[model samples]
Structures are given as structure tokens and as C-alpha cells.
Target: MVKLLAILIALCLGQAIVAERIVNCYWGTWANYRSGNGKFDVSNIDPWLCTHLSYSFFGIKDNGEIQSLDTWLDYDLGFINQAVGLKQQNSNLKVLAVVGGWNEGSTKYSSMAGDWNKRQNFINSALNLLRNNGFDGLDLDWEYPNQRGGNWDDRANFVTLLREIKEAFAPYGYELGIAVGAGQALASTSYEISNIAQHVSFINVMTYDFAMASDGKTGFNAPQWAVEDAINYWLSQGAPANKLVLGVGMYGRSFQLTDASQNWPGAPCRGVGAAGAYSGDGGYLGYNEICLNNWYTVFDNDNAAPYAYSGDQWVSFDNVLSVQWKMDFALNKNLAGAMVWSLETDDYRGHCGEAYPLLKAINMKLRWT
Candidate 1:
């Protein structure tokens, strides 16, 4: 019905852009486990920063019931209540719970979506979970419906699940969205774009995590035109312009340069770069960690993104300038809005002088004076 409403709004307004553009933000609950500046609680979030806040990675049981991944911290410790309570501060905020992330895998989702009786049970459980917990709705994050250890029938059944979920959500005025894969080949196999887009309130196209080749070379995690290309592909496949939201990653993929002299795209890498202090994960660095570095940064004019290199370490990530380019592309395409993968990674500590710098860049570009 959200799409229908958008169509009505566009028709009445006599313009291409419909309703309000949303900044859908995802919050990883595990960030609370990180020590020092890495520790991010639900309360640390500025409620007004995002139009929609998704509490990510609530698990699913064999019985199709939604389970908090961290029962102790998320539910018993009141993290769920704390996240929902943000709505009290900003009445316009819509807090959603995400089920079936990359870690959850496709087995549970495929099993639940394939069976008729199970889908209804899942819907009932999801609704009860949301209404009882004071959440605005659900954002299904099944990584890939048909692939990743799932059955062949999943491609069609996933649509049925979404359709039923959207129908069930309509009476309660709950929003239903999905995090879709951005790769061309993966997207074709995983989703029936037009069919699924019909049932969703919005589609958060995950336009990052790009790896160029298997040649042990380095590449930008998300290039500006690559994001635009994903948007265009989805649109061409019949997804609605207003229901599509472009995704931006708040982290960078780092690689250790094999020879310090060759420090550009396709340059050979020894392996993952040294771990960031906060993230403590090799091959990855948050914007908070990346921006604080004194590395020599170079911009890729063709891609409209930046990668920094110092010594044998190199990382490709979107800074404010590249983020602006992405948002501009979204605007030009008449897409709904922008989505940041997770709020925790994007310079949230103010060590870079301002907090949520990349997110603010998205908001600044998407919002007009």
C-alpha cells in the first residue's frame, strides 16, 4: 500500500518525486560489546538523525518465531525498549527490527517462506513481536533467498512470504522493507524484482561490498557510478523509483599492498590490511578509524571515491565528497532516498571533529534548502 500511496501522491502532486525521502539507518546491537570508543549503545543514537532506525539481526527460530539474537542485552537488559523509546523523543521516527542477516544464513528464511502454515505463524509472531514491543514494523534482511544453502523453490516462495507479510502489516500500518543484494547476477537469481517491489514499502539496495576480481588486487568497496548502476539496473528490472533507497557503507575494505610502489586499483595485495583499533578486524576499518589516519588519500575521478595509502596499507572507502556524489546520483535518478548500512561505523565518536560525518553528508545532500 505504500507504493500505491506513493503513486497517488505523485499523481496528485504532478511531479516525479513522491512523499518524504527517508534516511533508513541500521544499528548493529553487537557494537555495545566493543570496548572504549567502539562501544555504541542504543541511547547514544541521536533519535532525530535518521527517519527510520532498524535494530538489526534479530534471529529466527525453527518454529518461525522472532528471537532477539542477544536475549540478555537486547530484551532482558532493555536494549529493545531503549531503541523503541527513541520514538518518544522523535515522534516521526520509525523503529524497525531486522530478522535474518548474513550470519543467520538462508536456511531458516527458506524453510519459513516455503511452507504455507509456517508463513502465517511467522507473520503472527512478527506482528505480536512488533506491536507488543512498540516497534513501528519489520525489515526482513534474508541475505539471499535462493542461494547460500537454500532450496531452489525459495526464489518464488520468498515473494509469497513478503506478500503475506505486507498484507498482514497493512491493517496495523506497519512498514515492510527488505535489504536486497546489489550485484547484477545475484540480484537476478535472488529476487523477482517487479514482483517483490510490489509488496515492499521500500527496497534498501545494498550497493557496497564490491570486490573487483579474484586476482588478489585492491578495489573500491563502493564506487559512485557502481551505486548508480545498481539503481539503474533495479529500475530497468521494473522496480519503482520512489520505493528504492540507495545504500552506502560506513566502513572500508582494506588490503595490505604487496609492493608499496604500486598503490592504485588492481594493485597486488599481500593480504588484508592491519586491523583497526576500534574494529579489531583485519581487512576492514570504520570511518572513525580511517578518517583519523594521516595516510595519503587519492580520489578516483572515474569512480568518484577515495582510497588512502600509507606504507603497505591501503583502504578504499567513501568520504564526504564521494558520498555526496552518490546522493546526487540518487537524486538525479529520482530514487526515494539514501540508506547507511550501519550507524556505528561512520565516525560516530567525534574523533574526526564531528559525529556521524558520513551520515550527515548523506542527509545534507539528500535534503534541500
Candidate 2:
């Protein structure tokens, strides 16, 4: 009996070795595609930033067709073509499309899953889009699975859809990936990560955005300790380290308020504005969006998590230095790679060079290996 148990342990360890062979870093890009003003440039993608680059396919109408800010654009295949061309030039770069996001949420996931025909149609379209565009894989960003905000009802069924898509994409040699929420609260209540991890090449844990767009508590988007805790939970729940990629926020949240609420004081200011009530942004003034542009500012140290304050309004946003810390942590933990929320948010042209700094630092640290 003891010998049999040893054999079982060995086999399990071997399987784990295989599962964690690849690490991925994900970045989201909804504002870029739909920003309309062209303030952000996708063409400026730094191939050396990470091994893989990903963008979100946002503003997708209910029916599965791609929609732009002003027009029902046909399947031009221009962006994909351009992105693919860039990848072909750089052997180290791999691009993937991230479908669904926080704003769009998972509202239509169940509906798409329930109707087999629709699901297949969507899959076919996505696959074709990928193939024609020369994308290496597809990353599903379905915010939540069994949760309610997006009116999702078929959590198990959604997994079934993933199974089907993986089977379908296999023949074409297209890899499948997924982005999920982090933290114990989300882990216990929302995603079935352990059962689902085996199906994808990597699972991206969105380690940031903890405070929320509506809060007064200033904090980093993705704290390292929080990330550690979250990673430990997922691993405990059966997620392989190699198949797990840590997420870091390239941008910071900014808020605005009077001196009446000087909760967290002496925080750095790249510039201040009323955006992302729980985070920080520069020159972006006034509280016009969803949340309060509250009373806090945040920053993270060797940990990816951030802490901050603005008069009484406090916020925490991770700069490139903080992101580097998390990347090192991921490497130290023997995890796969990192995934950034979106590419456009980083200071590709100017604003701040946090994103580039983090990516460059990650490469520098990994150079020895």
C-alpha cells in the first residue's frame, strides 16, 4: 500500500511538471480599439516587453459582430493583419485576443453558451479571425462564471463551451487561454479555477483593481502579498504554478477631493485628476465617470500591491518599479509569466513610462537564466 501511494505521488508530481511548462503575461486593450480619438497607439507595441501580448475585443455587440465606436465596421481584418505582420517579424512575440471584459462583463456568455449553434458560430468566427490574422491563440476574458452581475446562469455549461472550443481549435493548432479574478472572495464565490485550469495553456489572475472604481480605501491595483495569497489559494485548489501567469496593473488610479479628508498623505503625484476613485490618473480632472475620485493614493514596494492618499482622498496605483517587484516574485515562486491588463494604458508614447519600465526590468532580471 505504501509503494502504491508513492507511485501515485510521483505521477501527480510529473503531471504538475508538465502543466506549468509555460507562463503568460496578459494586458487588456479596450480603450485603444474604442477610444475613437486615436489617443492610444497599438502600433507602438514593445515586443520585448513580455513573451506574449494580448488585447481585449471589447464593444462587441450582442450578436457576435465587431462594432466600432461610430460604425458597423465590416470584418476588415486590418488590425489583425497588422498585428500578425508585426509578430511575424519578431519571433519572441505572440499575440492573442481577449474577449469580454469588466465593462461588458459576462452578460451574454450564458446566452452564447446555451445555444450550441450560436456558440459554434462564435467559435468559428473567432478561429477564422485568429487564423487569418495570424494570431497564436485566443484568451477568453469572461469576467465571472457563476456570478450574477452579468446575469450568468450556466457556469458549468460555460466550462463545457471551453471544452468544445479547445477541441475545435486543436486541429488548427490554436492555443486557448483564460483570464480570471484573484483573491479569496472571488476564488470562493465566482470562478471554478482549479477544474478549469487544465483546459487552457495558462490562467491569468487579475491581481489588481481590488479597491473598486467606487471606494475611499486607497490601494494598489494588484498587491504582491495579495497576489501571493491568491496564488497560494489557487495552487492549493489544484492550479499548476507553471500554468499560472500573474497579472500586474500598468496604470495607476487617480482621484480628487478637498483637504477635508486627508486620509493618506505624502503620496507621489505624477499628476492628479479625478479618475478611478480608488486609484490615480494625471491631468484627468473632475469626477465624471462611475466612481468618486475619492480620498486616497497608493504605491507598492517589493510587492506589486500599492498604497496612496490625496488630502482626505487616498488611492494606490502601481508604477513600473512596483510591477518589476511582482515579476521577480513570480520568477522566485517558479510561476509561468506575467499578464498586463491592457497595452494602451502604459506610457507607450509619454504620460509615464511605468509599463515599459516594468517590462524592461522583467527582461533584465530574467536575462541570467
Candidate 3:
């Protein structure tokens, strides 16, 4: 009888803990200028639905200082302040400034993290930016630390940088997070996971882009197996499961098939698919554009993902069903939460059946509502 009572108490405590899981979403600063698609800005964001909103990117200068990727959008036009103002709607919402992206490259991060003086300079700049911009924290989006133009010692240096940042941010009650590669090969090579796990508050494991146009094949961009493998590997590397947030792509990878008849996973492909309606990027389609276009949908039961093929174009992306599956996976793994690639890609305008269907599916599965 006593043991049964203890079990009930623990279950209640677990429920209380789960109630605060992070539902982080990245809001792209450039989505406001998507041309053909209507503008998507901070005003369009539903702050209440997300516990944390990270502004997509800030550039890292060679001098280890953080700069705006877009001067106008980030500061001259006041979008940064507007994003931070979202806290007015949901007082508990945290707005973080994300620095570095694939395009930003790792040369600057490598130099900054490798040197103590440069690392301190960068940390100071980050704190200043966060304070001036009204942001609650920083989210490092460095593509890599020890690879992709970085040095061999970058793995250890990256952890040192994070620890310094965390130490500096602690007194101010600021949060620190990182967006990391989900592939086991990249994770093992680029990160000192055991050391890193102790510094950052959470890690956003990027599980998308598993298959790209460069691969010359058609496959689910973010397969279930890859996601599970990444989570498991991180856990094995001593990362606490509750501090890992699974990343879901709100966009799809596209490919132009060499032969329409052979359009399937691992089939030969010529190049990227034509430009998407909203994303305006070749070989990629945002969920908004995917819903707008009429393509024959194909489901991969084994991978728990969906793909679409039309004429000679093939695209792999996530829909409401797949997002639910990912959320359930997070729950089963006792993960910290789930995060979307970017907020602008979703059907935020209610054009695709319901507004924010992908995000809503995540909320439903996680019971955030």
C-alpha cells in the first residue's frame, strides 16, 4: 500500500514537470520579405502557443563580435524589439537571439572559440546584445565546431566557450542553448557532447536535411530512424534526455528526377526541384507552399514521413501526421521537448485547412494546450 502511494506521488510530480516542457520555434527574420507569399513578421506570430521563440540568425564577425545578418530587419527597422515584445502576450515566453547558421559559416566561430580573449569578447558582445535587445538568452547555431572549416581542437574549445557563456549568463538569469547536427557522424565528430551537455540549458538536435539535392536521391528529409538514432547517440554520449529537444523541419527537400518513372527513395535525381512558392529556394519547399501546391502524396510507413511527387519534381517534408509522430517519439524518450525549424514555414495564415496545423499537431501530441 505504501509503495502504491509513493508511485502515485511520483506520477503526479512527473506530470507537473512535463507541463513545462519547451515548445521552441525559430522565427525567421527574412520571412517578412518572401515576395510572392504574403509577409510573415513578428506580428503574425502566436506567442502564446510557444514557450520559447528564437530569432533565426545573427552573424558572427571576424572579430568575435555578433552582428545583424540583416541590418534593417534586425535593428534599423526594430523587428528585434517587436519580437521581444511578444512577451507581453505570454509572460512566460522566452525570446532568444540565435547566432550563426549554415550560410554564416564556421570560420569566425572557430577563431573566437579557440582563443580565450576572443571568446571573452564574443561572450561580452552576446550579453550586451541580449540586454539591449530585450532578449532572454542566446542560441548558438554554429554549423559545426571541429569541422566545416574549423580546426581539430574546436571540439574541446566549443565546450569551453559554452561554459564561459553559461557562467556569465547565470548571474543574469539568462538561458543558453545550441542547435546541433543530428547525424551520429557529425555529432560524434563536431561536439564534445559529455562536456557540452553540462553547459547549455538545452540542445536542439537538427534532424532534418537527412537527404538533400546534393545526395542525388529522393528520400525523407528527416527520417524517424535518424531522429531516434540521434537521440540515442546523444544519450549515450552522456547528454540528459530531458535537455534534448527534437528538431522537426517545417520545410521539405526537393529533387528534380532524372526519370519520372523511377521517382522514389534512392532514385537518381538531376538537381534540386524548382523554386518553392514562398521559400523561393530551389530544392526546398516550406509547408505553406507544400499545402498550396497539388502534388500526389506518398507515405513512407517505415520511416513515418510523407513525400510528394508531381510531374518530374519530388519533395520530402513533414505534415500534421508526421509532426504528431515526432512529438509522441519525444514523449516516449522523455525528451525536453520539440522545436520547429522556423515559424514562417508553417500554415500560419489559415490557408491550409487550419491555422498552424503542424504546430497544433505538436501541441496536441505533447498536450501543451
- Residues 150-202, model 2: lDDT tens digits: 44345666677788888988887788888888888886666666667767888
Poorest 10 consecutive residues by lDDT, candidate 1: 11-20
Q: Which of the two candidates, 2 or 3, achieves a greater lDDT against the reference?
A: 3
TM-score of each: 0.93, 0.75, 0.95
Model 2 is weakest, by summed lDDT over 10 consecutive residues, at 283-292
Please provide, for model 3 over 279-336, each residue's C-alpha lDDT reduced to its tens digit, 9 standing for 90 to 100. 8889988899998888999889899999999889999999988888888889999899
The most accurate candidate by TM-score is 3
- Tens digit of lDDT per residue, candidate 1, span 1-369? 999999988786653232368899999889898888889998679877798999998888888777878889987889989999998899989999899889999998999898888788899999999989999989999889889988778888988999999889998999998999997888988988999999999999999988633449999899877777788899999999999999999999999999999999889998898999888989989988899897999999998999999999999999999998998888888888988988989888789878888988887777532
| Number of backbone collisions per candidate | 0, 42, 0
Give the winner by lDDT: 1 or 3: 3
| 2 against 3, candidate with superior TM-score | 3
Winner by TM-score between candidate 3 and candidate 1 = 3
Worst 10 residues of 3 by lDDT: 360-369
